[model samples]
Target: MPLVALVVAALAIGFEQLIQWKYGPMGIIAFIALTIGLKAKNTAISGLGAIILVMLLAQSN
Candidate 1:
């Protein structure tokens, strides 16, 4: 159980860093928009999240 917990925690940290690197700075904005869209079931907000995420990715490359 302890070993599993350690692995899970490490995986979580790795995923967090991966997302940060993948999203760059606007990751926070996209995350917020995604959360709002999910909670409110709003397509417009979801679209905004997609747009923001795409824009950030495009800028990176």
Candidate 2:
């Protein structure tokens, strides 16, 4: 269980780093908004963040 958790954490960190490298501060901001919105149980904010992230990723490719 602990090893699984560790692997998940590591993968998450790596993805965050990849986003940071590819998209810079806007990526971080969108991620934070998504996380906070989810934690707060607000669909509107989370949706906005998700949209921003999707747009950013789409824009790149």
Candidate 3:
């Protein structure tokens, strides 16, 4: 249903905003890259984004 899809999208946007607030712009960039890469079916882009996310996680602790 369109309403369900809209709600999911709104939730996703809010979640992304939370991530950005907590982790900063790089987090947003990394997530965007990961999402886009997966959608586009590009392994290299996805791998790079995964690597960045891993690094960010490591740095957090």
Give the per-residue lDDT digits (tens) of candidate 3, residues 1-61: 9999999999989989987997799988988888889999999888888888888889999
Clashes of 1: 0
Best by TM-score: 3
* Best candidate according to lDDT: 2
Worst 10-residue lDDT window for candidate 1 reads 16-25
Question: Which 10 consecutive residues of model 2 have the lowest summed lDDT?
Answer: 27-36
CA lDDT of every candidate: 0.79, 0.90, 0.89
Query: 1 or 2, which is superior by lDDT?
Result: 2
Model 3, poorest ten-residue lDDT window? 15-24
Better of 1 and 2 by TM-score: 2
Better of 1 and 3 by TM-score: 3
Error of 2 at 10 (Å): 0.4
Question: Candidate 3: which pairs clash?
Answer: none
* lDDT (C-alpha) at residue 5 in model 1: 100
Q: For residue 46, what is the lDDT in candidate 1?
A: 84
- What tens-digit string does per-residue lDDT give for candidate 1 at 1-61? 9999999989967865776777765776686687689789999998898788788878879
Query: Which pairs, if any, clash in model 1?
Result: none
